[model samples]
Target: MEYITLNNGIKMPIVGTGTNTYGKENKDYNGALTNEIPELVTALELGYRSIDAAISYRNEELVGGILAESSVPREELFITTKIPAREEYVSSKESTRAAIDNSLKNFQTDYLDLLLIHAPIEDKEQLKNTWKVFEEYYEAGKLKAIGVSNFRKNHLDELKEFAKVKPAVNQIQINLKEKNEDLLALLQDEGITPVAWGPMKTEAHQQELLDEIGKAYDKSGAQVLLKYQIQRGVVVIPKSHNRANQAANLDLFDFELTAADVEKIENL
Candidate 1:
C-alpha cells in the first residue's frame, strides 16, 4: 500500500477501510450492532492495513476486538479513531482523557497510529481543553499523532491561537460532489493531510466522466476517482463489503494518471 507523510513526519497509508457501518445490521450506519465484522476480516486478508473508526459509530469495542484478534501485528496496522466533540467526551480534560483511555483499552494497544477530534467544537474553551489533552497524549507517546475532522479554515485559525502542534490531518468529504477545492488548498498550505470520506459518493454524471478517464488506464470509475484524490496527495478510505471491490480499492498503486488526465479530472 502507498503512504503519505503527515506534517509531524509520521507515515499513514494512503488507502484504508472505513468502518462507519461495519459490524452493524445489514451494513446500515444506524443498524443494530451484530458484534461481528466479517468484512473487516476480509479486508485484512486482502492486505488492508489502515482502519478508520470512530467512537460515535457505536462499535469501537467490536471493531477494536476484531482488529486485535487479527493475525496482523499492532505495529503494521495503522489504526485511526476519533473522539466526538459532544459533552460526554469533551466536557473537560479529564473526560476527554478517559474517552481516549477507553479507546486504547478497546483497541488492546498502548498507542494509536492517529487520533482525531471527530468534529469541531463550537465552545472555544472546550475545544482548547480537548486539544490540550490530545497534545498531552501525543507527547507521552500514547498517540503517534493528533488531528481534527470536519474543520473549516476559521476553526483551524481558532486552533492556531494557542496550538503548539499542528493538526496532522483533516478528515472530510472529498467526493466529486463535494469537491471542497478551497479547503483542500488550505490544507495543502498548512501541511495538513486531507483524508477523504464518502469518496465514492460521486454524481452519475461525474461517474460517467470518471469512467471515460478510466478507459485510458484500464481502471474503473471508482478507481479513477480515488486515484484523482490520492494522486493529488489526499488519503482515501473507501469501504466496500464486497471482497472484489475491497481488492480493487487497493489496486491503485499500479498505474499513474498523466498530467492531462489529472487536469481533466480536476476540471470535472
Candidate 2:
C-alpha cells in the first residue's frame, strides 16, 4: 500500500477500509456486531492495514475485538477515530477529554493513529475549545495526529486563527461527481492532507469514460476511479462489506493513469 506523510510527520496509508456501516444500517446492534466482527477480520486477513472508524458509527468495540483476535500486529495497523461534535462532548474541554478517553477505551488501544472532529458545530467557540483539547492530547501522546472533517474553507480559516497546531487532514466527500477542486486547492495551500470519504462514486455521464479507461488497463471502473484519486494525491477510505470488493479496492498499485487519461477524466 502507498503512504502519505502528514504535516506532523506521521505516515498514513493512502487507502483504507471505512467501517461506517458496521452497526448503522441494522436495527439490532448485537446482531450487527456478530456480522461485522468477522467481516472486519476478513478485511484484515485480506491485507487491509488501515481501518477508519468513528464514535458515531457505534462499532469501535467490535472492531477492537477483531483487532485483538487478528494475526496482524498492532504496530503495523493504522487506526483512526473521530469525536462527535455533540453538545455534551464539545461544549467544554473536560467533556472533550472524556470523549477521547472513551474512544481509546472503546478501541482498546492506548494511542490513536489519528483523531478528527466529526463536523463543525454551531458554536464556533465550542469548536475551538474542543480543538484545544485535541492539541493537548496530541502533546500528551494520546493522539499521533489531529484533524477535522466536513469543514469548509471558512471554518478552517477561522480555526487557523487560534490553533496552535494546524490540522493535518480534512476529510470530506470527494468523488468523481463532486471534484471540489477549489476546496482541494485550499487544502493544498494550507498544507493539509485531503482524505476522500466517498472516493468511488461517479456521475452517469462519467461512467463511459471510466469504463473506457479501465478497458485499456484491464481494470474495473471502480479501480480506475480509485487510481484517479490516488494519482491526484488524495487518501481514500472506501467502504465495502463484500470481501471480494474489499480486495479489489486495494488492488490499485499495478497500473497507473497517464496524464492524457487524467485530463480526459477532468474534462468530463
**What is the clash count for each candidate, in the order shown?**
0, 0
lDDT of 1 by residue, 39-113 (tens): 999999999999999999999899899989999999999999999999999999999999999999999999999
Clashing pairs in 1: none
lDDT at residue 199 of model 2 (Cα atoms): 90
TM-score of predicted model 2?
Answer: 0.95
Model 1, poorest ten-residue lDDT window? 259-268
Candidates in order, TM-scores: namely 0.99, 0.95
All candidates' lDDT scores? 0.95, 0.88
User: How much does candidate 1 score in TM-score?
Assistant: 0.99
Pairs of colliding residues, candidate 2: none
Task: Give the winner by lDDT.
Answer: 1
Candidate 2 regions with alpha-carbon error over 4 angstroms = 23-36
